[model samples]
Target chain A: MADRSSKRRTLRLKTPISAEDIADFRLGDVVYLDGLIYTGREGVYKRVVDEGAELPVDPAQVGNVNFHCSPAAAVREDGSYNVGAVTATASFRFAKWLDRWFEISGCKVIIGKGGMTSEAYRKHLVPQGAVYLTTVGYGTGALLGRGIKRVVAAHWLEDLGIAQAMWVFEVENFGPFLVESDLQGNSLFERANAEVAKNLDALYEGLKPPVMSRYGETDDRKDELI
Target chain B: MISTQTLQNVAEELMAKAAIEIPDDYLAGVKGMAETEEGDLSAFVLRAMLENYEAAKEDRRAMCADTGVPRWFVKLGNEARIEGGPVALEAALRRATASATHEIPLRPNRVHPLWRTDHNNNVGLNAPEIDYSFEPEANWIDLTAVHKGGLFGTDYRMLFPGDGIDGIKRFLLDTLIAFGKRGLACQPAIVGIGLGGSKDTCMVLGKQAACLRTVGNRNPDPRIAALEMELKDLGNSIGMGAMGFVGSSMVIDCHIEAGFTHTGGMPMSVHAFCLSSRRATARVHADGGIDYRTDPKWFTPYMRRETVEWQTDPASGARSA
Candidate 1:
């Protein structure tokens, strides 16, 4: 069932999202984060997790939220990264590292598109005080306009290219992010899927099969709900 | 003859438009969905999406970071005359991509697939994947540039002939559900389905349907058109609302196209496009006239499907229930 709340507001947050702050969030809650957030994705994760390289920011000061993104920017002649657009990429491929990312980076919130796939992340999250928030897939422009305030520090523009480098941003009121996975191990997506399965069952409940087997299918597909 | 400069300018303008701005049709669809969305969260998300589009346009900033690798679908007239021909045209497209990277400034998305070396200019071997079609009597060149988003990719499936249309429908629904499970590929998705043909051809048609077709358009084949409508309704009913928030308007549109297939096998491909649906079209005439349009008219050569008629209420802007 859809939440019928007519009024929606953004909850402004400070840096280092505490366990209490994240635990208070329910699945589907909308919030705005204003503080220091570090960005990392496939390339940085590969370097940190697989290659055992040291991250530039110390785990303690990197704050609670870590954005999973490969930002788009034009490298200026002065060597500073200009903010063109910053959008979340899918975080499923890096699912194995979700817990480790929290452990190593001390970030309790992971911001990315297409929520985490690994059930292991859920299990790891509850104890470690973490959650997964989903940015609107097409809200990248809004993210650039309002979410990101400015680029603070950047590493690996030369080594990893503009898209994959680790960019630290000073963000102000940075989200209308949906809490896809909460600290309680609850996922809005899992609930939605359960509903979808029911809807699929109901859709095929009483359909009759066509008289002619248009293609030469040996098996009878009449009324079988896939 | 179309000069090298003309081709380059057309490419640059189209790519820039596609990268930075949300085409008018897609914006209308998003607005319509926002009006009709059943879930509050979905509605909120839809409005946010519209704001994003507006902000990007007003700021002249690239909407989403993944300005995507360019996918060109070019239709050349038989009577078309050019100075350097296809080779020159290809060179112009490549150069435009490089130029646009700095102007609209597209994200350098092209990376060496195996070696992971970044091209930094969005140009590599077969960088801008280009496809061509020829119209024998026409004397113009029509190009549709689709900025294929780098978020997720097209879904493909091949089945034996015996599996039938039912199997195909199930595959599509299942694929959509899976996408929804993985946060629903940016919400209110535009689903493109390809039926029949070989693996690659079906995938191409699906891409065309997703990237080229407009929101309210229908397929020409009656049966296929009916399937399109059914899938659109069914997929929405799944309630994977904006970004997997449970809601009624999960999909904005479903575009399907079919081609002749082999006797032994059936191929069905699905491509899910985010609400952004970035695309732009340009037509260069023999008289040196150039026209730019948001609509690609991919189905211009095909027939219109006559399925069930829908009546809309003007006051409420709602289809008759």
Candidate 2:
């Protein structure tokens, strides 16, 4: 249980988030975003960063965008929103967009599967004061369980399919899961590194020579990359 | 001895079942998170996991699409046996392996080293992989199903492998990152990690870790418990935000499992749970007492389990997507 619902830092937008109007939100105030959090993964991200606000430009204003999510709804008839704010499934897109995505869309949350470039980390996490919270990996049903209010609007869903559709949602606190992101500029990965160092230092020392491959574009693994 | 084919079959079927009916305990775990999550981000993470649970339940597909390479670990009971399968565990495993390739439709995760798409997805060299170490007890094989999403890139995302500080942890982290990069380079998603064993087995275990159930509602392994809290913290640091962006939420979760490998060997393997994060598992008794299956209603609120929740077409074997 990391930081799920903390005071949301409010930022004025060049766009609107939903059909509903906005309220004054502070730099750090816990706010329940129930109107319309858009769903944009690989397809949507590229389109947004490339195209720049094609839709009504409503969802473009929000700070959160669930890229790793399944699908989401806007609201419940009774109002409280059948929300599904889960973890990030990131990693589908390239690292270059990491900063641009935040800069262009005003996305505070990017949910999906993996991590990003250190450059993006410093540029966004520290400067913007945004945080990423990781979720339990297999928690898809977690998204579907809260039950969706309504399929607000799915762009490219038919074309992109469920995995890459752009879904707008009226969500709850969405997570009490993993802090893959944090405004403090902290990361769950940092925590794991410390432990991995403590536990495997010896083995690492032993297998020093050959097996020590490079990461991403650095070394041997590069060959494995398609 | 239980042939590898038998083991393979059992593992495949069990995996298929998990895809179909996720346990009530797991469901309850999702409920547990939904009910009591503290941090706004963590709560959001929990809700996401539950959504995965819902997807597993209602979509009649995997919770995550990675579907991991089918793996099984058997605890043989002294009085128990494989009943009527082949001889060697390898054979049984192989047979089950083949059956699974056809029956489960699990994404043939393994690609040819050079060929890439040339993969049949399975049935390749040592396909439907199996790893086993027998206990003193003979006969009865306690088959356990485990499938984990790959957690790659996180360690590398943060650690400075090229920082010239060649530490074992750095090396291991770097190795996982390379694989993670490959996975992302292949497909960006939640990469499941497993560590322990000679360079190879640990790698297998990492994939196995995602398969290991979240300690959320189940019994806890002190080591694993510590790892969970720690991994959660470390994962975000790598800057692999929610879904690999620059946000704090990077990995969904780095579920892990370990075994007593040789004291000297610390093999770590990582399986990348692509964004699809597809996965599911099921257990059936000798009499076929099925333990669980994904409930369709679990995915769509619009769809109810009891009311008019249509089931997967039995004949075609397709669930209500």
Writing each residue's lDDT as its tens digit, candidate 1 over A1-226 gives 2335546545677888877778788777777888888888888888898888998778676677878887767777786666776777777777776666667887788888777643755567767778888887555653554567788888877788877888888888777678878766777667766665666676555444433333333456564433
lDDT per model, in order?
Answer: 0.74, 0.44
lDDT of 2 by residue, A114-204 (tens): 4444445566655644444333443443343343345566566445544456666544444323434444454544443343344334434
What does candidate 2's lDDT look like per residue over B49-167, in tens digits? Answer: 55565555564444544444555554454444454632465565555544554443343445456744324334566555554433332344555544433344333222222322233
Q: Which ten residues in a row have the lowest lDDT in candidate 2 chain A?
A: A14-23
What RMSD, rounded to one decimal, does every model reach? 6.6, 14.2
By lDDT, who's the top model here? 1
Query: What TM-score quantifies how close candidate 2 is to the native fold?
Result: 0.45
Instruction: Chain A only: list TM-scores of all candidates.
Output: 0.83, 0.60
lDDT of model 2 at residue B289?
Answer: 41
> After aligning candidate 2 to the native by TM-score, how far in Å is the CA of A120 from where it should be?
4.0
Looking at model 1 chain B, report the run of 10 residues with the lowest lDDT sum.
B312-321
Model 2, B215: alpha-carbon shift in Å?
Answer: 7.8
* Two-chain complex of model 1, DockQ on C-alpha atoms against the true structure: 0.35
